[model samples]
Target chain A: MDIFGVPIQALMGQLMLGIVNGSFYAVLSLGLAIIFGVLKIVNFAHGAFFMLGAFTAFLLGQHLGANYWVALVAAPIAVALFGMLFEWLFLRRLYGLDPIYGLLLTFSLVLVLEGGFRVAFGSSGQPYATPEALRGTINLGFMVLPIYRGFVILAAVLTCLVTWYVIERTSVGARLRAATERAELTQAFGINVPLLVTLTYGVGVGLAAFAGVLAAPIFHVNPSMGSSLVIIIFAVVVIGGLGSIMGAIVTGLGLGVVEGFTRVFYSEFSSTIVFLVMVLVLLIRPAGLFGREES
Target chain B: MHLRSLTLPLSIVAVLALLAIPFFPQWIYLVFVMKTLCFVLFACAFNLLLGHTGILSFGHAAFFGSGAYIAGHLVKNYGVPFELGILAGGLVAALLGAVIGALAIRRSGIYLAMITLAMSQLVYFFYLQAPFTGAEDGLQRVPRGTFLGVIDLRNDTALYYVVLGIVAVGLWVVWRTVNSPFGQVLRAIREHEPRAISLGYPVARYKILVFTLSAGLSGIAGALKAIIFQLAALYDVHWHTSGDVILMTLLGGMNTVFGPAVGAAIVAALNHYLDPFGAWVTVITGVVFMACVLAFRQGVVGELGRLLKLRRPSRPEQTADQPARGESQP
Candidate 1:
């Protein structure tokens, strides 16, 4: 299984790492795309929400004695509820203003949430042990793989597929898309557009939280954990073309692998490489890979 | 006419009074205040691009951090005078801004922001790996040296005066730039790009030029800061610095001349006061941002300016609705 003098074992190891990272990237970007498409806001607080989700899981586990599965499901829901509250209380007012206001507001929200978390939990990374059920590794013929990594990859893919199916194929998805495209007309059809908007925001933020829960065992939960990843996700969203779910999912996964490979070859440039790709993508296709042309 | 003639002298007096801060018992507090003032210049410079030019930059810290690094290196290794070190930092940042801005301005909106962010991250990595920057340890123990070869900037009084002088000059330049015909064109572009383009303005070139100027000014602030603090660390170049500047500008009022300064002062003071709260600083910053955007959109200074009716006279009213005023298309 060796190629180019690199061991198959090492290659498989990096590949597994790439896939796991890709899972998080895919899920997070999917949420971003959904929110952007419907709300027309970049939702800069998305990363903060993700951080909160992980922390929620940690808190619930520690205090409520909640098991991993329960925390996994409940954390995102809790985050979604918070997201709904935010939309209702703050974001709904800014829909008429420039998109910059939305970006600014969400940016502020990120600061507050991240700051609050840091103050409460301290600045250091908190460790979350992997659940017993998903512990250990599986020995494939060519290479060994972590069971948790495989689970993350599988779960992330399932989430993406379900989201895509719901948004693209179902009647509810049709209503959602219509509401975004023409809120007034959707209202004329007797559908509650405001509720739909709130629900969409919740669902989008919830996805970010879900990814956070999945990421807890792999990445240490920390106050500043989300800050580093948020910028990269922004690049991903831009390259994929904001508001395009498929584009977000595809670009997120693909860029994660590209980043992983860059780490293998040029360790120093790994962080900047994604941004470089974004620049190149913008140069070649201003509207993004899957973004519709702005009228 | 009386008010017009008194403006410069009044501002000078104000500047001198600010310079007198170190005479007080709270000299240590003056250092902290001066540092915040430096960030005000950074944020205001950034707002020239983001607020007036309507181009959100995600990589502005490249200029700022690079300037700090260059200044730190010059003071530490080359033994250059403090003024020269700051000047060299500004020049380096200007050069970088010209190159990066040229490439980035080819795209619009989100693409532009992403490209700048990437370019800055690239520079951040470069600084991290570059030998002179000291990588992880950063450049430290930088000498403050003498100001203009006479006054010792190492002394708190001298440093406070130097910082005040720099802040006054930077603010004057920003005010002048925003009020000039060139600045009006920029505002036009921000409010309506198509109209500005149709009016025969080279929109992209103007944007890039202003961006370069702003970046260079911000570099001056960052470089001066490194000299004052006697250190240039990796944290200065990180995206968070860029975010901090954005927060400052947004919190203070984006387009107003004094907004970034006021915002910087408040944020810096809060940072110092809230040191006990640790990581919660981010949460507080986020809350402020949310509150500002949700309600205080005009920002602290901008809102104040509006309240006081101190906004610069409207360009349209001054020009008598003529299309051919100044450099207007024939």
Candidate 2:
């Protein structure tokens, strides 16, 4: 029953929790990587958009009596549509400028979204209950785990794989890659690069929303939820390297485990350790763990 | 051309407005304005590095919060005079900045931002664990010691004047620095680092120096704020505070001297008025930021400057005798 002076069950449970956290991290960071790959802009509002997705789910479930399953699908799509509008209406104009401006623009968007949400919902977090189907627990050899958490992890992994496949394997993915590398040439080929750009933004934002919906049950839905988590995600993005999807996934999972271990060993440092790793990674491999060197 | 000379008059008018704040019936309003002014100074200091030097620091709250902690400790423990406490707090921040800036200048762009962020996080952790920071409770119930051993700072009127004077002095220093030759070098480095370096200018040194100066000034603002509030909480050192300052800078107009002040004032006032709206304050703030970035890129003061044509004179407009130096010192 005991392992390394800790209960095997407790350790296994914590690991399960860690994996769940990692799943969210992977999904969110993947979205960021996709956007940065093409736009070269660090989307500071990625977390806000994610929060919007959760809130959208909350509202939909409240007003339309939509089930959790319905929200899980619709929230991301809705957020993606909104994101496309933002890209078309605003971010399109900032393509050729310094990436800092893009960062600033997104930072501002965060303020707008977060402030607006706070006004609407108040500061207190609202709970979104897990569906009855997921209310039970599964007993394993060493530990008991929540069925809902397992579902979240499975859903996240499936999402990540589908995103990876779409971006890396499909003809559409080829075009998106082409647009990222050479927009003018892609446009010259009559590929509608502008439209692709907008879609990319939407997809990136949509992914964030999906993560938000997934997270709503675990973490209470709140306006300020995005602010705390986004910074860590940013660090993850940095450690993983911008524009590297695999990097994001690997780093997200790895850091989540590291964070879990830290919590067990040194609780005080659980939060700051991620940033410390980021600093070390930057010094050791400035381009990031998986990023290609900029020419 | 004659309007250029109005800078002095405009500054004086602004000072007068601040001086007359006590005449208002709402004591809370005066305190609010004082808070805004402190933030304005903080934002302006932030701009020295961000707007002029082209380095966006995400960890500026380290200096700001550290300054607050030092001031709080001095008043609560050592019983130091207000002026000395504030001065000591700024000095401490400057010292810390010297070290942080030295390490940070090695990187550029996003990397620099990350490094500052990491450093600030380190400081935040230190404060969280350190005994002097009072842990989670924070250094609370700080005394409003006498200003220069003369004016009683416990009085709201007295505190208001002290804050006003500090803001004025801080603004003046920023203005003077921006116009000075050293400031020009900092700008040059921002606009074109390689070109400035090629001209035999030590670009790194200039950047680090400016960063330290900015940190020190921000510390002063934070210290004054701690004295005014009689408390130094964990929130001061949080990365969110850094983001708030950045918001103030962007909203007001990063490049202009008074823009951050105006932005800070507006945001502080918004917080007061929007308190009734509850959580929507964050949503509104986010919306405003998004709108500003998408539509009002020039920011409030920047737009005003453009509309009024209060632009600073170009290098060419300056006396033609001083040719702009090239990177390579011939």
Interface RMSD of 2: 2.6
Each prediction's total of clashing residue pairs, residues at least 3 apart in sequence or on different chains, is 12, 26
> Each model's DockQ?
0.59, 0.46
lDDT at A248 for candidate 2?
Answer: 87
First chain TM-score, candidate 2: 0.97
lDDT for position A128 in model 1: 92
TM-score of each: 0.92, 0.90
Docking class of 1: medium
Per-model chain B TM-scores are 0.87, 0.90
lDDT per residue for candidate 1 within A1-295, as digits (tens), equals: 6677678788778877877887888999999888887887878788888898999999999999998899999999999999999999989999977777787778778777877776677788999989999999999978998899999999999999999999999999999999888889999999998899999999999999999999999889997777677778887877787757788999889988988877777767777788888768767886778877654
Model 1 vs. true fold: TM: 0.92
List, residue by residue over A210-259, the lDDT tens digit for candidate 2.
99999999999998888767888887876887767777888888888888
